[model samples]
Target: MPHPNQLISLLHLASPALPIGGFSYSQGLEAAIDSGFVTDAETAEVWIRDNLLHVQAHAEAPLWILLHRCWQSSDHAGVAAWNEWFHVSRETAELRLETEQMGWSLARLIAQMGWGDEGLRAALLAQSPVCLPTAFTAACVALGVDAREGLTAYCFSWLENQVAAALKTVPLGQVAGQRILYRLYPALQEAVAEAARRADSDPPMLSTFSPMLGVLSARHETQYSRLFRS
Candidate 1:
């Protein structure tokens, strides 16, 4: 079993109500549904799983691990570089805004909790945009969470938010959402492993090429009717 403090910190960081405004963005899931790509619970599960494997596992999860280590090692330049890379990799204006906005919100939350180091806080305040993964990694480090546990919590937090988005947009029942999350367990584990391996190497190149998702997100910017931010 994990240390009690670490487990509690993970739970706190992974909470859906973390006040980072994560609930507002579906990360293009709404657009996917609008285009008839993800309508039902099963389709939702498949869409999320594919993203988890192809996009997130390859990109953001690895970055999250890298940022976690940067925070641990006091590598401020690495943190800033990775944060900017993530911001630029966002395909659409809305996607970029979503990350920047959420990043700022999480940074503020850290400030409010008084868990932030002065240097990190100053860096975040000075920066025009801080990506969510960087802020979250900094938060985990401040809270004294280990990298493996922090990365797990980070992925799970994302999973929970996506599941909630599916429940609201796909109009899935609560039980169906729970079932989808349950089904994603294996993929989530694989993602954590992949991220760990990537983090062990020299910082890997960032890749955020999801053509279909890019199309959907771009279309979502002009969507006739929408329930999510992106």
Candidate 2:
């Protein structure tokens, strides 16, 4: 059982207010929006859900777990070691940036908190090429938050950002964005369960098998008139 302070830490780690500069990146929503594949609210919901489940869940989430385990074992070098797989596994440049930038920002923010700075800074300074989940998991642990709570919030926040991106780029209504978020709750829960299961697994196998989505991520890099990064 977790302590009261532990639970409070979990809440803070999971809260949407925790700044990792997530609102700036779209995770490929801009390209999907321009491509007509995600123009409407209904279509936008499907696209976001697909991304959360297929891409982030398998590819990025495992990195979080590995980073958490690395912290637990005090393998500062191991964090840097994981970057190779992050690059090779993720098929596109923009996708890589989205994760790394978010991870880096999260690391920087966590560093200023005056807690868990030693291991976290060492891991980041080693050029870990961290992803959002990687920074998120590390910060959560440093803050005394449990992994499950950390992951739960991470999953929800991912969805929230995508929905915001969709609302702006895809032109989905405010109400529609809420609907999309409401619909994704169950999927997030399922992802949390999956994350828990893979906590010990070594970077589980994953790829964005959604061909159209991958193309959009690639195309977003050159979208001459775009509002968000992939």
Index of the highest-lDDT prediction: 1
Q: Give residue 121's error in model 2 in angstroms.
A: 2.7
After TM-score superposition, the amount by which residue 85's alpha carbon in candidate 2 deviates from its true location, in angstroms, is: 1.8
Cα TM-score per model:
0.95, 0.87
Q: Write the per-residue lDDT of candidate 1 for residues 1-230, one digit (tens) a residue.
A: 54468888888889987889999999999999999999899999999999988888888998998888888888888888888888989999999999899999988888888885888777666656888998999998888888888888888888888999999988899999999999999999998888777667764744787999899999999999999999
Pairs clashing within candidate 2: none
Query: Which residue pairs collide, candidate 1?
Result: none
lDDT value, candidate 1, whole model: 0.87
Tell me the deviation in Å of residue 80 in model 1: 0.9
lDDT of 2 by residue, 24-95 (tens): 778678887777777788888888887777766765665666767777676767766665566556668987
Question: Which regions of candidate 2 are displaced past 4 Å?
Answer: 14-16, 198-203, 208-210
Task: Indicate the TM-score of model 2.
Answer: 0.87
